[model samples]
Target chain A: MEEVERLQHYFQVLSDVNRLRIIKFIDKEKRSVSEIVKNSSMSQPLVSHHLKVLKNSHLVETQREGPFVFYQLTNPKILDILGLFEEMLPKENLVSDFSPMFCCPSWWGNSN
Target chain B: MEEVERLQHYFQVLSDVNRLRIIKFIDKEKRSVSEIVKNSSMSQPLVSHHLKVLKNSHLVETQREGPFVFYQLTNPKILDILGLFEEMLPKENLVSDFSPMFCCPSWWGNSN
Candidate 1:
């Protein structure tokens, strides 16, 4: 693909709220599909679908540990892009920064 | 719109190649529609359409000087975002940085 086309595809893949949320959830550390679904409050199928798109775009990658699959960002530079976007946004539009969680969503009472 | 939705829309607006081209053209200084059309080699209507979308998204702001309208980026931080993206891109996929030109494309040997 041409340089412009690849960038257009990358931006298109990033043009989703759910995908951004999922990306943020998995930024600092790898997470299982269930963990992403739980943190994002998105359905398992939907989370998986977004993960597939992210992986296809080379924005994300995965590893297998036993029966579990872990997904992580392919490049840490993605976080830098996200940070720039956040900086451009209005303060009111800002969300709290992602804090990686090892425990279940219910156990934390929705701090994410 | 919600924060996520607004961000999604922002990214969606940025997902187009022409829009990115136009944004880069107007990054440092304001340029008239005719100027953009000349540099982009895009039709007048297409350039106008992309400019309208960018204006609507608050990505580009317009100022009228007599009969001609000039567009400039709303924030300079956008360049930082573009810089980060360029850094993340493969070396072969990268394009030369924009050098603002006051003359017609033919006046120079397509150095841009």
Candidate 2:
């Protein structure tokens, strides 16, 4: 039941575009609130709210270094979820063919 | 971009507990709107609305068998997504240990 709840919560957290963007951004490296705000072009409050949701969902974990809170993907376990999604969802041959969207390095970095 | 849209749409469709329950039901066998409504204890209109959303998302496809429209999981492709999610998410040992939640047979059937 806890696992179900966690999975449900994770899915809910991923449902938002902003949160998904945040996850995508943070996928590269741990980021402070301001950095995420800058990259996502979302309001601080909105980002904070989504971060709270992500935190509660266990999709992300925060570390306070000095005055800044650095947010990072906590559970590498969720990568399995992303992996499953990649396999299950329709694969874009164009993205994979021309670009390296499915490639490990590109997918793991913010270069794409 | 189409693939991303489809994935996002599918995730959005799965976000709802009611929709998830509906999908879980249809996973076993194709079900009519009325049967889904009865099993889920939700209203016909609500079920119809969800089915429409699921259909639009390509998570579930409908077949008009006689007068009754039967809904079934359209893209077995989404199963790969589910598989990736299972790998990424925290594994429930209890569910897998005692019962066979992760097993193919039980997962494909209506039986718990």
Candidate 3:
């Protein structure tokens, strides 16, 4: 049943577009909640909810500097997982300008 | 919205314990409904329903041989996806004997 729990946790994490976007942001660079809100369309409360779930599932880890909490992905391989999933999507389903991104690899190189 | 539908689909497919099992069985080899039911703990109706969803999402494909139809994974790359996820499972979460079954490589190698 651990497999069920582990998988259910992961699937639940991946199922939410906000959570996936949060991971993409953290994967790009360690970020505080404010930095995350600045780059992402999600508001403070939605980011908080997704971050809590990602942290509980161990997919993400956090660092604290006095009053600030910075979050980063716990595993780099998760990038590979997300990349593979992106490959599965047809090119047409993605927006032409790639605004309102579902996911992309350039976040790491394009920023920070 | 298309990305939402697509991710919702694949996450929904991978999330269910029974649906993952069906993919495992078919991924091992193309199987008839009876072969699936025989290898899986799910009942006839349940298997039928999961198959419908998987088929709808194109994660699975089926072929007919006279009165019997056989199902198989639509893409082998899905194997790499599942395998990567398996790598993330902690060593202890798995039952030592591996009795209940899960997404495993040997389902293809050990059988048929």
Candidate 4:
């Protein structure tokens, strides 16, 4: 159950576009907060918050150099998860392509 | 952008514990609403609602047999996503074993 909570929290954090973008910022190389803001539309505070969430999820790691903090991926395997989820998402199965074969408005199994 | 919404919605629904359990029910074989309710502690309406969400995500499909409705997985590929995410979740990386490698509270890259 604890593992379930951890996984759900991980997905919850990744469900945000901003957070995904932050991952992209460092996907190629380690980035300082300043570098991310320079390339991304997110403000400093927002970037900081997103990074904290990402770090807490272990999706990324941070290194401190004097006053500069550099953020890079802690779990590179997360890239595989993100990439696979994107690839498997019901891309073609959007509403336009999806329809029930013969769904019932009610299933009689529930008598209670 | 549309794909992003679809993926996010899919994850959002899956982020729930109940929904995940419903998925488990239908994952192995087709189950009528009553079958799910009979076997699981969930109420009928709750099972139905979760099924609708699953169906909308193309994670499950429905078919009618005479008067009985059967719910089954529409996209078996989703199993891989679930399995992979579970495997990749910071299971070992959980805070019990995780420690900061010298991260700063601030990232200097973001000025704005």
Total backbone collisions, model 3: 0
Model 3, A1-112: lDDT tens digits are: 5554566546756777777777777775889988998888878887877787677566777888888889888886787777777677333332222123444576666320
lDDT of 2 by residue, A1-112 (tens): 5433444544665766677778778884789999999997899998998887676555677888899999998876555465457566544222332122444665677432
Q: What level of docking quality does candidate 3 show?
A: incorrect
Off by over 4 Å in 2: A1-7, A90-112, B1-6, B77-80, B83-87, B90-112
Candidate 4's C-alpha runs over 4 A off are A93-112, B92-112
- lDDT tens per residue, model 2, B31-74: 99899999988999989888876665556767787889998887
Clashes of 1: 0
| TM-scores, all models, native as reference | 0.73, 0.70, 0.73, 0.76
| Model 4, residue pairs in steric clash | A33-B109, A33-B110, A34-B108, A34-B109, A34-B110, A35-B109, A109-B34
Error of 3 at B30 (Å): 1.2
How would you encode candidate 3's per-residue C-alpha lDDT over B1-112 as one tens digit per residue? 6554556446755777788778767775889988899898889988888887776566777888998889888786777677777786333432222133454585677431
lDDT of each: 0.75, 0.66, 0.69, 0.72
Highest-lDDT candidate:
1
| i-RMSD values for every candidate model | 9.4, 9.6, 8.0, 4.9
